[model samples]
Target: MSDQPPYTWWPAGLRRAGAALGVLGVQWYNAARTNIGATATSTVFEPFVTTALAGAAYARPFVRFAGTGTWTLGRAHFAVGDRSAELLAGASPPGEGTYGYTVTRYTNEAHKGNGLYRDLTLELVEVTNAAG
Candidate 1:
Protein backbone atom coordinates (compact mmCIF):
# COMPACT_ATOMS: atom_id res chain seq x y z
CA MET A 1 0.00 0.00 0.00
CA SER A 2 1.25 3.47 -0.84
CA ASP A 3 1.25 6.09 1.89
CA GLN A 4 -1.21 8.89 1.19
CA PRO A 5 -2.83 11.72 3.09
CA PRO A 6 -6.57 11.64 3.85
CA TYR A 7 -8.80 14.11 2.08
CA THR A 8 -12.36 15.51 2.41
CA TRP A 9 -14.36 12.58 0.96
CA TRP A 10 -12.48 10.14 3.12
CA PRO A 11 -15.40 9.72 5.54
CA ALA A 12 -16.89 12.71 7.37
CA GLY A 13 -17.11 14.63 4.13
CA LEU A 14 -19.30 11.93 2.65
CA ARG A 15 -21.79 12.23 5.48
CA ARG A 16 -21.89 15.98 5.01
CA ALA A 17 -22.42 15.57 1.27
CA GLY A 18 -25.20 13.07 1.97
CA ALA A 19 -27.10 15.73 3.91
CA ALA A 20 -27.74 17.67 0.70
CA LEU A 21 -29.50 14.69 -0.90
CA GLY A 22 -31.69 14.20 2.16
CA VAL A 23 -34.56 16.06 0.62
CA LEU A 24 -37.07 13.28 -0.13
CA GLY A 25 -36.40 9.85 1.31
CA VAL A 26 -37.78 6.35 2.03
CA GLN A 27 -38.01 4.25 5.21
CA TRP A 28 -37.94 0.44 5.61
CA TYR A 29 -36.82 -2.52 7.62
CA ASN A 30 -34.30 -5.27 6.88
CA ALA A 31 -37.03 -7.99 6.93
CA ALA A 32 -34.43 -10.71 7.30
CA ARG A 33 -33.71 -13.73 9.55
CA THR A 34 -31.42 -11.58 11.64
CA ASN A 35 -33.53 -8.55 12.48
CA ILE A 36 -30.45 -6.48 13.18
CA GLY A 37 -28.93 -3.53 11.36
CA ALA A 38 -28.72 0.26 11.18
CA THR A 39 -32.19 0.93 12.61
CA ALA A 40 -32.97 -2.49 14.09
CA THR A 41 -36.76 -2.99 13.86
CA SER A 42 -38.23 0.38 14.85
CA THR A 43 -37.92 2.34 11.56
CA VAL A 44 -35.02 3.24 9.34
CA PHE A 45 -34.78 5.30 6.18
CA GLU A 46 -32.40 6.66 3.59
CA PRO A 47 -32.35 9.79 1.50
CA PHE A 48 -33.73 9.15 -1.98
CA VAL A 49 -35.73 10.62 -4.80
CA THR A 50 -38.40 8.69 -6.69
CA THR A 51 -38.32 8.82 -10.45
CA ALA A 52 -40.59 7.47 -13.17
CA LEU A 53 -38.97 4.60 -14.98
CA ALA A 54 -37.72 5.76 -18.38
CA GLY A 55 -39.59 3.41 -20.74
CA ALA A 56 -41.77 1.37 -18.40
CA ALA A 57 -42.76 4.43 -16.41
CA TYR A 58 -46.10 3.20 -15.15
CA ALA A 59 -45.11 -0.47 -14.88
CA ARG A 60 -41.97 0.28 -12.92
CA PRO A 61 -41.36 2.77 -10.07
CA PHE A 62 -37.76 3.90 -9.77
CA VAL A 63 -36.09 5.13 -6.56
CA ARG A 64 -32.63 6.66 -6.32
CA PHE A 65 -30.64 6.41 -3.11
CA ALA A 66 -27.00 7.05 -2.27
CA GLY A 67 -24.43 6.48 -4.95
CA THR A 68 -22.29 4.54 -2.48
CA GLY A 69 -21.94 3.18 1.06
CA THR A 70 -24.14 1.25 3.55
CA TRP A 71 -27.00 -0.24 1.55
CA THR A 72 -29.47 -2.19 3.67
CA LEU A 73 -31.37 -4.92 1.80
CA GLY A 74 -34.79 -5.92 2.97
CA ARG A 75 -37.81 -7.82 1.71
CA ALA A 76 -40.27 -5.29 3.05
CA HIS A 77 -40.24 -1.48 3.16
CA PHE A 78 -42.41 1.64 3.55
CA ALA A 79 -42.49 4.72 1.38
CA VAL A 80 -43.59 8.16 2.56
CA GLY A 81 -43.62 10.71 -0.18
CA ASP A 82 -46.02 13.61 -0.76
CA ARG A 83 -43.94 15.81 1.48
CA SER A 84 -43.95 13.03 4.10
CA ALA A 85 -47.71 13.12 4.25
CA GLU A 86 -48.57 9.58 3.17
CA LEU A 87 -47.02 6.67 5.03
CA LEU A 88 -47.27 3.00 4.10
CA ALA A 89 -45.51 0.38 6.16
CA GLY A 90 -45.30 -3.30 5.34
CA ALA A 91 -47.88 -3.83 2.62
CA SER A 92 -50.41 -1.42 4.05
CA PRO A 93 -51.09 2.26 4.05
CA PRO A 94 -52.92 3.66 7.07
CA GLY A 95 -56.36 1.99 7.13
CA GLU A 96 -55.75 -0.12 4.03
CA GLY A 97 -54.06 -2.67 6.32
CA THR A 98 -52.88 -4.72 3.32
CA TYR A 99 -51.21 -3.76 0.06
CA GLY A 100 -47.65 -3.09 -0.93
CA TYR A 101 -44.99 -3.98 -3.47
CA THR A 102 -42.38 -6.71 -3.46
CA VAL A 103 -38.80 -5.70 -4.07
CA THR A 104 -38.04 -7.62 -7.22
CA ARG A 105 -34.75 -5.99 -8.01
CA TYR A 106 -32.19 -3.66 -6.48
CA THR A 107 -29.66 -2.25 -8.88
CA ASN A 108 -26.66 0.07 -8.70
CA GLU A 109 -26.70 2.76 -11.36
CA ALA A 110 -23.70 4.73 -12.53
CA HIS A 111 -23.77 8.00 -14.40
CA LYS A 112 -22.03 11.41 -14.64
CA GLY A 113 -22.96 12.52 -11.11
CA ASN A 114 -19.88 12.01 -9.07
CA GLY A 115 -20.29 15.66 -8.11
CA LEU A 116 -24.01 15.24 -7.48
CA TYR A 117 -24.68 11.48 -7.61
CA ARG A 118 -22.31 11.33 -4.62
CA ASP A 119 -21.20 7.75 -5.27
CA LEU A 120 -23.81 6.02 -7.47
CA THR A 121 -27.51 5.55 -7.99
CA LEU A 122 -29.70 2.81 -6.49
CA GLU A 123 -32.63 1.58 -8.48
CA LEU A 124 -35.33 -0.55 -6.85
CA VAL A 125 -38.29 -2.15 -8.58
CA GLU A 126 -41.49 -3.18 -6.90
CA VAL A 127 -43.54 -6.27 -7.75
CA THR A 128 -47.29 -6.96 -7.54
CA ASN A 129 -47.20 -9.15 -4.45
CA ALA A 130 -46.57 -7.78 -0.97
CA ALA A 131 -43.14 -8.06 0.61
CA GLY A 132 -42.44 -8.37 4.34
Candidate 2:
Protein backbone atom coordinates (compact mmCIF):
# COMPACT_ATOMS: atom_id res chain seq x y z
CA MET A 1 0.00 0.00 0.00
CA SER A 2 2.99 2.33 0.49
CA ASP A 3 5.22 3.64 -2.28
CA GLN A 4 8.39 3.31 -0.23
CA PRO A 5 10.23 0.04 -0.13
CA PRO A 6 9.89 -2.11 2.99
CA TYR A 7 12.79 -2.06 5.45
CA THR A 8 14.94 -5.14 5.98
CA TRP A 9 17.73 -6.00 8.42
CA TRP A 10 20.45 -5.67 5.78
CA PRO A 11 24.08 -5.45 6.95
CA ALA A 12 23.34 -6.84 10.37
CA GLY A 13 27.05 -7.01 11.16
CA LEU A 14 27.52 -3.26 10.73
CA ARG A 15 24.47 -2.61 12.88
CA ARG A 16 25.87 -4.77 15.67
CA ALA A 17 29.25 -3.03 15.52
CA GLY A 18 27.63 0.38 15.75
CA ALA A 19 25.55 -0.69 18.73
CA ALA A 20 28.65 -1.95 20.50
CA LEU A 21 30.53 1.30 19.89
CA GLY A 22 27.57 3.24 21.22
CA VAL A 23 27.81 1.37 24.49
CA LEU A 24 31.43 2.51 24.89
CA GLY A 25 30.66 6.17 24.21
CA VAL A 26 30.39 8.61 27.12
CA GLN A 27 27.40 10.75 28.11
CA TRP A 28 27.33 14.55 28.08
CA TYR A 29 24.80 16.87 29.63
CA ASN A 30 23.93 20.49 29.08
CA ALA A 31 24.47 22.20 32.44
CA ALA A 32 22.23 24.94 33.63
CA ARG A 33 21.21 26.68 36.84
CA THR A 34 18.04 28.71 37.14
CA ASN A 35 16.60 30.84 39.85
CA ILE A 36 13.34 29.15 40.68
CA GLY A 37 12.21 31.53 43.36
CA ALA A 38 13.65 34.84 44.47
CA THR A 39 12.70 37.23 47.21
CA ALA A 40 14.28 40.22 48.95
CA THR A 41 15.78 37.85 51.52
CA SER A 42 16.79 34.80 49.55
CA THR A 43 16.85 33.14 46.15
CA VAL A 44 16.60 29.48 45.21
CA PHE A 45 18.54 28.00 42.32
CA GLU A 46 17.62 24.74 40.64
CA PRO A 47 19.45 22.53 38.23
CA PHE A 48 18.07 22.65 34.72
CA VAL A 49 18.78 20.14 31.96
CA THR A 50 17.85 21.11 28.44
CA THR A 51 18.83 20.62 24.80
CA ALA A 52 17.84 24.15 23.95
CA LEU A 53 20.64 26.62 23.40
CA ALA A 54 20.79 30.03 24.98
CA GLY A 55 24.24 30.70 23.49
CA ALA A 56 26.07 27.40 23.27
CA ALA A 57 25.80 24.13 25.18
CA TYR A 58 28.28 21.23 25.35
CA ALA A 59 26.01 18.19 25.47
CA ARG A 60 27.19 15.37 23.23
CA PRO A 61 29.52 12.38 23.19
CA PHE A 62 32.68 12.01 21.12
CA VAL A 63 35.47 9.48 20.98
CA ARG A 64 38.52 10.81 22.82
CA PHE A 65 41.77 9.53 21.41
CA ALA A 66 44.33 11.73 23.09
CA GLY A 67 45.30 13.29 26.40
CA THR A 68 45.30 16.98 27.42
CA GLY A 69 47.29 18.12 24.45
CA THR A 70 46.97 19.00 20.80
CA TRP A 71 46.65 15.95 18.56
CA THR A 72 45.74 15.11 15.02
CA LEU A 73 43.18 12.47 14.14
CA GLY A 74 42.72 11.77 10.46
CA ARG A 75 42.59 15.42 9.34
CA ALA A 76 41.43 17.02 12.61
CA HIS A 77 43.74 18.70 15.12
CA PHE A 78 42.53 19.83 18.55
CA ALA A 79 43.46 20.23 22.18
CA VAL A 80 41.66 19.20 25.34
CA GLY A 81 41.47 21.64 28.21
CA ASP A 82 43.03 20.67 31.48
CA ARG A 83 39.72 21.14 33.24
CA SER A 84 37.80 19.01 30.78
CA ALA A 85 35.23 16.68 32.23
CA GLU A 86 36.27 13.12 33.09
CA LEU A 87 33.21 11.95 31.21
CA LEU A 88 35.10 12.83 28.03
CA ALA A 89 37.58 10.16 29.00
CA GLY A 90 34.83 7.50 29.26
CA ALA A 91 34.30 7.95 32.99
CA SER A 92 30.91 7.41 34.56
CA PRO A 93 28.46 10.27 34.76
CA PRO A 94 28.15 12.46 37.84
CA GLY A 95 26.26 11.12 40.84
CA GLU A 96 23.51 12.98 42.73
CA GLY A 97 25.76 16.03 42.92
CA THR A 98 25.21 18.93 40.54
CA TYR A 99 28.29 20.72 39.22
CA GLY A 100 28.67 24.04 37.46
CA TYR A 101 31.24 25.04 34.89
CA THR A 102 32.23 28.20 33.08
CA VAL A 103 32.95 27.83 29.43
CA THR A 104 36.08 29.84 28.73
CA ARG A 105 36.26 28.78 25.11
CA TYR A 106 34.98 26.18 22.67
CA THR A 107 36.39 25.10 19.33
CA ASN A 108 35.19 22.75 16.62
CA GLU A 109 37.30 21.09 13.98
CA ALA A 110 35.23 19.89 11.05
CA HIS A 111 36.17 16.62 9.44
CA LYS A 112 36.65 16.81 5.71
CA GLY A 113 35.07 13.47 4.80
CA ASN A 114 32.10 13.67 7.15
CA GLY A 115 30.44 17.02 7.62
CA LEU A 116 27.94 15.49 10.05
CA TYR A 117 30.53 15.04 12.83
CA ARG A 118 32.88 17.66 14.22
CA ASP A 119 35.65 17.40 16.78
CA LEU A 120 34.73 19.66 19.68
CA THR A 121 37.25 21.03 22.15
CA LEU A 122 36.15 22.96 25.18
CA GLU A 123 38.02 24.94 27.80
CA LEU A 124 36.09 24.95 31.05
CA VAL A 125 36.68 26.30 34.54
CA GLU A 126 34.81 24.72 37.44
CA VAL A 127 32.80 27.16 39.49
CA THR A 128 30.77 26.96 42.62
CA ASN A 129 27.51 28.73 43.35
CA ALA A 130 26.99 29.47 47.03
CA ALA A 131 23.49 30.71 46.27
CA GLY A 132 22.42 27.37 44.88
Candidate 3:
Protein backbone atom coordinates (compact mmCIF):
# COMPACT_ATOMS: atom_id res chain seq x y z
CA MET A 1 0.00 0.00 0.00
CA SER A 2 3.12 2.29 -0.03
CA ASP A 3 4.75 3.76 -3.14
CA GLN A 4 8.11 4.27 -1.38
CA PRO A 5 11.00 1.89 -2.12
CA PRO A 6 11.29 -1.28 0.01
CA TYR A 7 14.67 -0.20 1.41
CA THR A 8 13.32 3.25 2.37
CA TRP A 9 10.41 1.71 4.24
CA TRP A 10 12.49 1.43 7.42
CA PRO A 11 12.89 4.46 9.70
CA ALA A 12 15.92 6.62 8.85
CA GLY A 13 16.96 6.93 12.50
CA LEU A 14 16.89 3.17 13.02
CA ARG A 15 19.01 2.50 9.95
CA ARG A 16 21.55 5.16 10.96
CA ALA A 17 21.76 3.85 14.51
CA GLY A 18 22.41 0.30 13.31
CA ALA A 19 25.18 1.44 11.01
CA ALA A 20 26.74 3.60 13.72
CA LEU A 21 26.77 0.68 16.15
CA GLY A 22 28.44 -1.54 13.58
CA VAL A 23 31.21 1.03 12.99
CA LEU A 24 31.74 1.54 16.71
CA GLY A 25 32.11 -2.21 17.24
CA VAL A 26 34.75 -2.34 14.50
CA GLN A 27 36.81 0.42 16.13
CA TRP A 28 36.73 -1.34 19.48
CA TYR A 29 37.87 -4.63 17.95
CA ASN A 30 40.80 -2.91 16.24
CA ALA A 31 42.04 -1.43 19.49
CA ALA A 32 42.18 -4.78 21.28
CA ARG A 33 43.65 -6.61 18.27
CA THR A 34 46.51 -4.12 18.00
CA ASN A 35 48.10 -5.92 20.95
CA ILE A 36 48.92 -8.82 18.61
CA GLY A 37 48.48 -7.41 15.10
CA ALA A 38 51.37 -4.99 15.49
CA THR A 39 54.08 -7.02 13.75
CA ALA A 40 52.03 -7.82 10.69
CA THR A 41 54.79 -6.68 8.35
CA SER A 42 58.58 -6.80 8.50
CA THR A 43 61.67 -8.35 6.87
CA VAL A 44 61.71 -11.08 9.52
CA PHE A 45 58.33 -12.58 10.38
CA GLU A 46 57.28 -11.92 13.96
CA PRO A 47 54.97 -14.49 15.47
CA PHE A 48 52.03 -12.69 17.14
CA VAL A 49 51.04 -14.51 20.34
CA THR A 50 48.01 -14.03 22.58
CA THR A 51 47.45 -15.64 25.97
CA ALA A 52 43.99 -16.12 27.46
CA LEU A 53 43.76 -15.79 31.19
CA ALA A 54 40.73 -15.68 33.43
CA GLY A 55 42.54 -13.61 36.05
CA ALA A 56 46.23 -12.75 36.37
CA ALA A 57 48.44 -15.51 37.83
CA TYR A 58 48.83 -18.81 35.97
CA ALA A 59 46.84 -19.18 32.75
CA ARG A 60 46.70 -20.96 29.43
CA PRO A 61 48.37 -19.60 26.32
CA PHE A 62 46.92 -19.45 22.81
CA VAL A 63 49.28 -18.94 19.92
CA ARG A 64 48.20 -17.53 16.55
CA PHE A 65 50.00 -17.61 13.21
CA ALA A 66 50.03 -13.95 12.17
CA GLY A 67 51.58 -14.06 8.71
CA THR A 68 54.26 -15.68 6.60
CA GLY A 69 57.65 -14.25 5.64
CA THR A 70 56.29 -12.81 2.41
CA TRP A 71 52.96 -11.68 3.92
CA THR A 72 53.16 -10.11 7.35
CA LEU A 73 50.99 -7.89 9.57
CA GLY A 74 53.42 -4.96 9.24
CA ARG A 75 51.18 -2.48 7.36
CA ALA A 76 47.94 -4.41 7.79
CA HIS A 77 47.68 -4.44 11.57
CA PHE A 78 45.49 -1.36 11.94
CA ALA A 79 42.11 -2.54 10.74
CA VAL A 80 41.63 -4.39 14.03
CA GLY A 81 42.85 -1.85 16.54
CA ASP A 82 39.98 -2.48 18.96
CA ARG A 83 38.99 -5.95 17.84
CA SER A 84 39.70 -8.75 20.30
CA ALA A 85 41.42 -11.88 18.99
CA GLU A 86 40.41 -13.99 21.98
CA LEU A 87 36.91 -14.83 23.00
CA LEU A 88 35.79 -13.70 26.46
CA ALA A 89 34.59 -16.17 29.09
CA GLY A 90 31.09 -14.82 28.79
CA ALA A 91 31.09 -15.42 25.04
CA SER A 92 31.99 -19.05 25.48
CA PRO A 93 30.04 -19.73 28.67
CA PRO A 94 32.86 -21.78 30.19
CA GLY A 95 34.26 -24.69 28.18
CA GLU A 96 37.33 -26.75 27.37
CA GLY A 97 38.95 -28.69 24.54
CA THR A 98 40.37 -28.01 21.07
CA TYR A 99 38.54 -25.29 19.18
CA GLY A 100 38.76 -24.04 15.61
CA TYR A 101 38.92 -20.39 14.57
CA THR A 102 39.36 -18.23 11.51
CA VAL A 103 41.63 -15.27 12.01
CA THR A 104 40.87 -12.32 9.73
CA ARG A 105 43.86 -10.10 9.14
CA TYR A 106 43.04 -6.54 8.03
CA THR A 107 45.33 -4.41 5.91
CA ASN A 108 45.39 -0.84 4.71
CA GLU A 109 48.05 0.35 2.20
CA ALA A 110 46.71 3.91 2.24
CA HIS A 111 47.30 4.36 5.99
CA LYS A 112 50.62 2.54 5.63
CA GLY A 113 49.51 -0.09 8.16
CA ASN A 114 47.43 -3.25 8.63
CA GLY A 115 45.29 -5.09 11.22
CA LEU A 116 43.70 -8.49 11.96
CA TYR A 117 40.60 -9.84 13.79
CA ARG A 118 40.19 -13.56 14.41
CA ASP A 119 36.76 -15.21 14.44
CA LEU A 120 36.57 -18.54 16.29
CA THR A 121 34.12 -21.05 14.95
CA LEU A 122 34.61 -24.03 17.31
CA GLU A 123 34.84 -21.63 20.28
CA LEU A 124 36.66 -22.50 23.54
CA VAL A 125 39.74 -24.71 23.57
CA GLU A 126 40.82 -25.26 27.16
CA VAL A 127 44.20 -26.97 27.22
CA THR A 128 44.91 -26.84 30.93
CA ASN A 129 42.95 -25.36 33.81
CA ALA A 130 45.10 -23.65 36.40
CA ALA A 131 43.78 -23.05 39.87
CA GLY A 132 45.05 -19.52 40.19
Question: Which candidate number has the best lDDT?
Answer: 2
Candidate 1 clash figure, as a count: 2
What ranking emerges by TM-score with the best candidate at the front? 2, 1, 3
- lDDT tens readout by residue for model 3, 77-129: 21111222322111221122334434344333332243453432222334343
**Residue 63 in candidate 1, Cα distance off native in Å:** 11
lDDT preference between candidates 1 and 3, better one: 1
lDDT score, candidate 2: 0.32
- Per-residue lDDT over 36-87 for candidate 2, one digit per residue giving the tens place of the 0 to 100 score: 2211111101111212233222333234222243332321111222212342
Q: Candidate 1 clashing pairs?
A: 67-120, 91-99
TM-score comparison, 1 vs 2, better candidate: 2
Summing lDDT over every window of 10 consecutive residues in candidate 3, give the lowest-scoring window. 20-29
TM-score for model 2? 0.28
Model 3 backbone overlap count = 26
Residue runs of model 2 more than 4 Å from their true location after superposition? 1-96, 112-116, 130-132
Please, what is the whole-model Cα lDDT of each candidate in the order they appear?
0.28, 0.32, 0.23
**Colliding residue pairs in candidate 2:** none
